[model samples]
Target: MIRRHMFMSALAATVALSGCGGGDKSTATPTPTATPTPTPTASPTYTAFPLAAAAEFNTYSAAISYTGDPATSAVTLGAASTETLSTRVRLATDTAVATGTYVMRENTEESRFCVPTGQTCTSTLVTPSAVGNPEFVFRTNDATTAGKFSQVEYLNNVVKDTSSNVPALVLNRVSYASWWRGDSTAGQKRLAYTAWGYSTVYTDMPATGTVNYSTLTVTGRLVSTVGTTTAINKVTGTVTMATNFATGVVDMTLTLSTIPTGGGAPVAYGTFTAQGAIPVGQNQWTGSFVTGSPLSGTLAGGFFGSQAEQVGTVFSATGTFGGAQQRLIGVVVGKK
Candidate 1:
């Protein structure tokens, strides 16, 4: 074998070399873990994650509540009172929320004082997206979400007057739960809770001590055809208004019908009676159901001196307001 040798350099380059007997290559350490490598094999990939993500596409509703210290002066006792807020929201997934409206009532507790005492409070919403002009709009705050908690925002549009002890109007975010039912689910609504996306709400109604708190209390009925493809919903609601401060009488009713797609098929209808003081510069109205038949007419001969306008299929309801009889008329033009 060739003689091994070591060598050293005197140059300032500091290069050094050694000559020695040839030795076997040093051993390498055995790695505790094998290097993971992505194999180029074929297997079925799951889409469940994306499928679950699609859950956000459905309709969502949430309840909300918040508190506000009414800005008041000594002259106004309830003016700077404590006001509470309640509201609901509906939205399509991933699309900035659609129209949000307050659920106004005829006898919300808060409205009584704001409208004047001894009156019932009422709630209303700008459905049909045609409230002409909305009374309030809220910009949700960065609210923490647990389970079923939606977003939060500050509602600035509704405010208690400087002369009243009322709460400010508040916009309500929604709390949402989801369920899935397809032809495959076998009529089962697979419900699931979402993390940090839900809330409860009460309309922040301003009212005095006398009538009900301001809130929407209407009944809704949804009738759907097989497969839930075609739905029919009818809504009837009422708002009771306070009579004069002396009379202390208030009554009003409202009926709302929505077909989801208007004229297509109604998914719900709401109707109720509300009682509260009329808004400033507004008239108080009431309603009642008088005796009337769908298919009944009297002979013209029995009319010694009577006049009745030909009633439509929708019928009519009459009530007395301020000791004066009042009448309200409605018609069914599209699909029920």
Candidate 2:
């Protein structure tokens, strides 16, 4: 059963976001038996996470919990003070997520009961819901160990690229939602994981409009494994998102000469920056490097926009490399 009670502003999310959320991962899967030991090689200087990649996932951390029954077990009256209660909790199974149109249902929870007096019973219950935020970051990979979880790449947002830098007006906004199965190892090991997120970006950037070979929208998420320093408790999947404009430019081709494994990989530290010229009040000028990924949806008062600029017109962007082995992909459209 789900119950909504008092709002606890003091309570943060429960899930843990490792590293900064973005991570570089090569196509090669690590051998599960041995610690990855790929040899490091030289790669491009600029970087980006492969499919929602980030270096912060390697270092970002968090903790969370709820004070309710996981529903997987029944609360048996203790004959003495030494009896134990056994149950499993599922986060999504205990949640009701919907608004007006779409109502998606994904269950999370399990229960069990025993009196220790030769009596046993079984029941089902939804796990209480909980979650936490994580630091959002992005990093890239090379031909070698691009996606292994080690000392990964991240954006040194604190440092500005000489080419262009400005105060964070809207700040970067990112969020996420995740579900867990009861049979998972983490739960079996008395562990629980909750996934949640948010971001602080500069002032929101106005649409520079749409261009050929480009996309525009503003929604992103942070995803990574959660566990202790010794072992991985929960292996997180990809945090998919759609962005027509994620600030700056993405490289078109990234080739890796060498690959590294086991030890930490190299990193590229810089900025993912971009700015567009949109006509505000006709002939007037106002612009901002995009603070969020711009996506295209239905038409509203101001949903779709279009704009273009000549190539090699001195439209410059900058980024950084965490190590020697980082690759970046950028795309530029419009005639030169």
Candidate 3:
């Protein structure tokens, strides 16, 4: 998540602007106002790990938390703070995966994570084609805390769809859990614990036009759990990808048919519409949308993988349901 310190900094800037230009101008040489020193903002710190020998690809998921206040000193997933990093890391070489490093820096732009643009972070990778579960640790450097660390675990697997002989990554899971000591006098507290699973199999859109505009049709089971009750419904949707291959820009629109409520009255959930973007060669797309007509609530999340491959596509979303504002989290796995 984006640190709350950004809001604080914006507030400080507003105050500074409001106080300026009202002071009397002296006839003597005016002393230039000294620039205020910028306060340090919390960012994610990562520890590099060597890749396994037989690992060709991997997926990672991580979460972080801090003690005391989150404004000045906080921890978060890098770059895509709103969404956890659940990316597939492709190895570059036949050698063992080399150690890669990342350092926390001040936040500047809303989208980019580190400050001063390109000089903010660096990474090194060595490739191999093996798979196994591994764990990593990261240390934090901030004004209010020391010795804070974040841990991540990865579970890897390969799955082949019965429809196609091509094997794709599937059923991979990552767990992020951390504990940190905020104050010197206090004990460490559990910071965060979250798990995410994904599959490489995705709904593929058929080639349509000159630019290769495509539409993907997916039919799957949607399972949702709220409190102690669970519901399952058949889901059908089509995703249209408008792609500009030259610029590597792609936008997607999703339309879902009505879903069953599984209630005694047998009321059906309303249709839903969502929009998302697919970055260049990245395997994930994320966006948000609102429910239509009789249903009211906003939903946000993303789909993993691309349309070119017939790999299983894993989707996850979190939002509220119905007028009662019931919290809902849903996951859909579509495989041919």
The Cα local distance difference test for each model comes to 0.22, 0.20, 0.31
In candidate 2 the C-alpha lDDT for residue 24 amounts to 35
lDDT of 3 by residue, 1-336 (tens): 356888888988888876774454645678999999998754322211122222232222222222233323322211111233333221111121123222221122011112223444222111112442222223333435454332221112221111112122232221122112233322232222222333223233323331333424333233333443434444445555454434444343445543565534323444545444445445454444444422222222223333332221233333345522222222222222
RMSD of each: 28.6, 35.9, 26.8
lDDT of 2 by residue, 247-317 (tens): 33222211111112232442222233343332332211122224431211111011111121111111111
259 Cα displacement, candidate 1 (Å) = 1.4
Which wins on TM-score, candidate 2 or candidate 3? 3
Candidate achieving higher lDDT, 1 or 2: 1
Give per-residue CA lDDT, model 1, range 193-255, as digits (tens): 111112111112112333322332222222222221323233334332222323433433445
- What TM-score does structure 1 among the candidates reach? 0.20
Ranking by lDDT: 3, 1, 2
Query: Each prediction's TM-score against the native?
Result: 0.20, 0.17, 0.30
lDDT of 3 at 314: 30
- Could you say which candidate leads in lDDT? 3
